[model samples]
Target: MQKQETTRIKKEDKVKIIAGKDRGKIGKVIRVDKKKKRLLVEKANMIKRHVKPSAKNPQGGIIEGEGPIHWSNVMLICSSCVKPARIRMNILDSGEKVRVCSKCNENIDSK
Candidate 1:
């Protein structure tokens, strides 16, 4: 088995949808599936999935769910400035590491 490499995007992180039908929409990252390299952005790229009737559901119905979107199609939205910005690793004097926004030079986690 091979260990998968991840890009380190986290939940509650603001992001901008850059591709697919949800292009230009901005939202917080609700989930990150590292194994699949997919992301579930809050209120982004929703689709209906039809499912057969089960014991719980007597009738088959269409389920509204969030579809997996590739991570590449998303740009990290700076929490501080509230804009889509690139992330840069910064080390504090105390050796604490954090990601900062390249655009505003503000700490992405400060917000």
Candidate 2:
């Protein structure tokens, strides 16, 4: 089995798609699947599902929703730079690890 790798991306972070049909699109991170190394970005990588009639849904039909995209395919958009940039881990004086934007050298973590 493949080991689950850690990701710098987190929920609510803005990201830009670097690859795939959704390339160049930007969206907020909705969910993260560490086991699959995939992210569910809002309004990105949309997929359709055929749902059968169930108690929850009296009318069964097609459903459109965001699909999981590989984490490597998206780049985090730096809040300071307002651009998609690489992230590096930084250890602050307080010993708290935080993500730093490579382009602007700004802390990605919100206070």
Which candidate's lDDT is highest?
A: 2
Model 1 CA deviation exceeding 4 Å by range: 1-5, 54-56
C-alpha lDDT of candidate 1 relative to the true structure: 0.84
lDDT of 1 by residue, 6-111 (tens): 5557888878999999999988888998888999998899999999999887797998888888988899988778788877879999799888889999977655
All candidates: TM-score: 0.84, 0.92
RMSD from true fold, candidate 2: 3.0
Instruction: Check candidate 1 and list the clashing pairs.
Output: none
Displacement of the residue 75 alpha carbon in candidate 2, Å: 0.3
lDDT of 1 at 56: 82
Q: Report the backbone clash tally of model 1.
A: 0
